[model samples]
Target: MSFKKRGPFVSLQLMSRWKNLVGLNVSIGGFVGKYPHCFEIFTHPFRRNLCCKITQKLKEVIVEEENVIRECEIDAVKRVKKLLLMSKNRVLRVHALRLIRKELGLPEDFRDSVLAKYSLDFKLVDLETLELVDDDDDDDDESLGVAKVEEWREVEYREKWLSEFEMNYAFPINLPTGFKIEKGFREELKNWQRVAYVKPYERKDMSRGVERFEKRVVAIIHELLSLTVEKMVEVERLAHFRKDLGIEVNVREVLLKHPWIFYVSTKGSTQTVFLREAYSKGCLIDPNPVYNVRRKMLELVLLKNRHSKELSRTGDETHEEKSDVVISSHDDWEGERDGDWVLPILMKSD
Candidate 1:
């Protein structure tokens, strides 16, 4: 998409120069060939060199996603406000927010479009930090302290008729399929779930018990995932907000400890932590417009070969086929591994 803004197409040589920067191990032309549905490789009309441009379908999806994000500015503001409220200092680094902007459904120019437009609600402490502006008219400060998970706990307690002992201070845990439940695992999981800790939005004291501190970290990660559009986030991206959010422990270890509450997937280059309860059969239970559009793009990428074959059959090829470049099959791609993408759980026996 960035290449599209520069011109109709970018030379493969130019793209190859920065392939490592984009984390692509394969040559730029080879990478572009793998996803024919999203990109088209062609001979440059004047330069006579190999070049690539995003396909019309992908361009439309990008525009549609941008439109959807713009339409959801109000909700984005609420998400930002909630994030600010959940932080330990009631302030978040601009760089940290930028890392997870797409996950939070913020627009590309959110600094101007969302935060600056709603200046009364958000304040720029400096060029790099953002803080929420306090509303003096609102006397109910306690209401602001309630985290999103507390609402779920309330629902489990009242509507589902779950006892406080079972639901209170507990997160909704959905263990993955085929998870081996060893003889004392259930009892241990139950005890861990029942362990109380300070909520993500609440204040914390200086007490440093290991169990309490770990549980608090779990809650912080849980709330962070809940705020995302897909109920997942890159583990390294979460580390960017560690100082602002008070996540002092190793983020990946904390995620690995709570198997039921979080699932760490080593599918891509980065490790992503998925909130287990938010997904059913690998699909989000509650997907938003931005997620839907992004999913469409993913679907397009997944069906690249089929789309290319269809275009060939219908005589609808968009680019010339005279080039000597050999596009490899999807299986030849570097990261195309078979079987389940989820990493195996490494549980320690008590």
Candidate 2:
């Protein structure tokens, strides 16, 4: 939550305004208090108001995470280049790129650091759009036109010795746990997998049939998920790229229809789509630096409850010790009360 704040500390009053944004049922102070390990509550000396800030440990973790991302700038550039190559026009909207910037491991200032720095590879047409520059005149069309999935398809064909009809158009699918295989399900799945469609990076004529068009949309989504760090993204976030990616149908419905290739999780407030093959037991099969840093952040957040419990127990012990000392002092006074009466009377009389 502090990561989203613009300043070092956020006032309780200001944080209250973000209650709806953060989906908090209680006051911001109450929510922040729960996460003692992650956040520190303090009073501003000048303002004399309650404020919240991230703990020193959490701040260091955030800085370390940023440094890790900075170190991976080369890979981030490559991801952006591949994205441009995957687009229909070899151009993508700046807004769409911003939506998935973190997922793609690009820096916060990617506009200047990435697009402007690599001027020979990327042409900034305007403030809102960028295009890929053709660096080599001798480069053939086929070399620039391949989609990432084509490699997987080729391997499937060569290693499995599957027929061209089965391997060329098929996508790898991994069903989720407890997915019952109904009668004729395998036959139906096989038929759908064999249906041919235009690859995501390939050009298609307007006269293509509905089946082919929908299948191409599936390919586009698969490629997009593969590009992400987690191989998962919110369904709503993906909707922002619909126009730029040439997806016309309902994205949610499309994901639901192909459950084998994708998994729609409604576990939280947002519906997230995950590439089935990229994950095992709810974890990414191959984690990247950015993903590892994010997992560290999660661990820090989860430690808050345990930290709070420890503090509570220490406070209770301190209170008990004080009570025991007071009780002992009271007992000593009672025992000496009968003998001390003479000294008190003498002092009063004098």
Candidate 3:
């Protein structure tokens, strides 16, 4: 993914290292041959083998990618800022943030670019925590500030419905279709959903209704998942943050209780909990800016694939006119031979 890691070119002799991973099925020369417009093979700088270099067109594509990241930076900032504001003390541990910083679209030196740049909005205290500044007088940057308490409520026009205790965030549950539900389970969830408890942003009050405790558990998990790039995270990874997030021992049971908001996929060896709202038909529905940038990264193609498409569109004439390559026969290639002897760095004893 680093544009300059290979120094704008790679040796054909080393293509095998990347072929399978990059989905290539041709020899390095054939690969470069297929995309003569996008890639060229030249003698290696110091070695006898040849290397493939990206054409000017590919450089232009990389430039466009940089522009997209710049355009999406503001949206990404608000996303990460909202996550910090949602924490219990409006602060989260530095280590915890680092774990998901890539998923949060933070650059490696976020302390300077993101945290320092948003100094009025965020601060790294004691080099150990990221805390949100509590000033809320300005509406201009509210998106980067603690969201209004009322906004946490899942439903609007709450004054007309339910009591003061039920005035808490309405944790809506929309189960996947055809999911069987027993009457007792439905009844318990109905009470639990209506039960009011501490939101992820508020101070915890242990003294609460029986159902309120369960609601808080769900809220904690909800906020945690919301912080992810895909609004989903590995169940195993989530377990590590249990103590930090103030989760109880019955985390697994709590996750099962809300199949609507959270969907656990056993696709991998471990379970991954996905926020249903962020996905549709197994694909991310509204991908975050971080993920969008990754998607753009994926759009990049090896020179071979790009060249093949160009030839198909313009015919062999274009390639004949453009390429001056004279590929050598495989037998002439100086690869490892049966009689070749290995050299030892240390001298043999007499």
Candidate 4:
């Protein structure tokens, strides 16, 4: 039978409100009435177009609603159907079913579907009644219809697997022996593994762990390689400075071009002769970037000796000469001050 129509104005209004029906069940009376305003508007040809538009929009909403209901019911069905077959633990079964219903957007304070495939119900202590309920389920019977719930569940599981697989990015690594490839990368990997309980999962955990580990490791290794190269540059600079400054008194300069250098230079005369080399070496030392920035701050503390044999000859002569000069100068200066200088005496033994 043809449905009653509404006027163009009313039909347009209804069209505007069509999308709001999402998740709402279309009332039978509302559908049948077509409403007085809607009928008047929809009777005209132009108004009829508005009615059609509204109807199409409502159809889309209906389809989406159906899908949501189907999905939610499917979850409950899987739980209940499984419960029915295993045939025990009524409380758990009911709870699972209730959870599924809630997930499906069904009312929390409501009854199970009145139109459930089976019209059976059971009270506590009625084990026979429960058994009958299970037996009546068409889902378990092969001769009966295939449960759409099972099909939907498989689809859901497949979707989940694909989504998680796409995100998997960890790799297996043997710790202690395998150094990190990135800065702090090893620690991050360890934390992730621990959080995921990867060790207990073994192979499954390793597969993902290793993949993620590889990326982080590669990044770390690159940084370390760069740092090593930078360190070598510093060492070479030091070697060039030492050789140029002529501080090769003891240690051999065999490995002058080596990545690591051993050498020293004086800050005084040595610096002037080997200024360029010294400067280059200083630049390479890069105290700020090194592990211990203060390593270069220490200066030599030299101890002087008063009676060392090496300086004894010069020491005696200087001591005697300085004493004579001090005595003569003191007496002469005093006489001049008193204005009694009687021709500054030049004493000598003829």
* lDDT for model 3: 0.57
Better of 1 and 3 by lDDT: 1
TM for every model, in the order presented, reads 0.85, 0.80, 0.60, 0.20
| Tens digit per residue, CA lDDT, model 2, 1-350 | 23223246655566566668645566666766666766665544544455556655677767777798789887777777777776777798988898778788777789998889989778999998989886657364455456657778889888989889887888988886799999999998898888788787666653278887888889889988888887887788888878767887899999999998998887635678888888777677889988777777777666656645443222112111111110111112222223211000000000
As for lDDT, the candidate ahead, 1 or 4, is 1
CA RMSD per model (angstroms)? 8.1, 16.5, 11.5, 45.1
Quick one: best TM-score, which candidate?
Answer: 1
| Tens-place lDDT digits, model 1, residues 52-96 | 667667778878888998998887887788788878778999989
Off by over 4 Å in 2: 1-7, 136-145, 308-350
- lDDT-wise, the better of 1 and 2 is 1
TM-score of 4: 0.20
List candidate 4 segments past 4 Å from native.
1-55, 67-76, 79-110, 114-350
Local accuracy of candidate 4 as per-residue lDDT tens digits, 233-265:
222222232222222222222322111111223
| Per-candidate clash tally | 0, 0, 1, 26
- Which residue pairs show collisions in model 1? none
lDDT of 3 by residue, 1-350 (tens): 33334344544555545556544555545655555545544554334455565545555554554565456666557766676665656776777666555555555566667777888877888787878777768675454433333454524455456554655556646778898887798787666666667766565565376576777777777776766666766676677556556675567777876788888776524567877766667557766555654444344432335435443322112332233344332222343332122110010010
What lDDT score is found at residue 350 in candidate 1?
9
Task: Tell me the deviation in Å of residue 106 in model 1.
Answer: 0.7
Best by lDDT: 1
